[model samples]
Target: MRYPILIEEGSDTTAFGVVVPDLPGCFSAGDSLDEALDGAREAAAAWIDAALDAGMPVPSPTKLEDARRLSGYEGWTVGVVDLDQALFDDSIERVNITLPKRILRRLDDLAAARHQSRGAFIADLTMVTK
Candidate 1:
């Protein structure tokens, strides 16, 4: 999804801030505009990951015009972040990943406790975190 981001310019006393209007609580900051935007992408992904983990419906991306209509956004720079298809992709593609036996055991136990398969449990964590 292409989510619109608002970049609030900062002066010498503060850092640039980014806010993803479509995703509440999704924000980031950096010394420069580029950095702030890079952080915003990561923030957006984390937000979606958290929502998915919580079993909540992922909110649709707000239109750019609608997002800009929100008050208090005057003079803010706008940009769009194109998220990876994997965030919404349902096709299964398997690969090998090596992990410590201890950690693997712990993961298995946790997945079982949740009444979920190890792959699903791991996929949720890895997708959000990676």
Candidate 2:
């Protein structure tokens, strides 16, 4: 899954640094943004390999709340990314279904009003309906 990468922007020792919260101890650094990103990719690869080897739970990316907690780290600011969508897509399933024309139209209207897709509307309805 795509875990959030937190780049601490201001550090005296490192110009750029990456921390993959999902992968404990998975961290890398560089003197520039490009280098930092490269380091993060390498770190992520090694992190995944080790996790697989140890049969450990791979964590999803850290959220804003988690990143905000790192504010205590001196001279560091967090940067989060949603770049790992593909990794997490497996967590959900996709299904197709047919509905009556009138029901479909009603679903479409409801979805538009809620700014959601018909599928999403159906999902929400399922959750709240008996």
Best by lDDT: 1
Reference-based lDDT, each prediction: 0.86, 0.69
lDDT of 2 by residue, 21-125 (tens): 767788888888778877887778766655644567767566766766765454555664434444323245788888899988988999999999877788679
Q: What is candidate 2's local distance difference test score? A: 0.69
Count backbone clashes in candidate 2. 2
**Candidate 2 lDDT score at position 38:** 79
In Å, residue 115's CA in model 2 sits off its true spot by: 59
Query: Best-fitting candidate, measured by TM-score?
Result: 1
| Cα error, candidate 1, residue 34 (Å) | 1.2
**What lDDT score is found at residue 29 in candidate 2?**
84
How close to the true structure is residue 64 of candidate 1, measured as C-alpha lDDT? 87
For model 1, the superposed segments whose C-alpha errors exceed 4 Å read 94-130
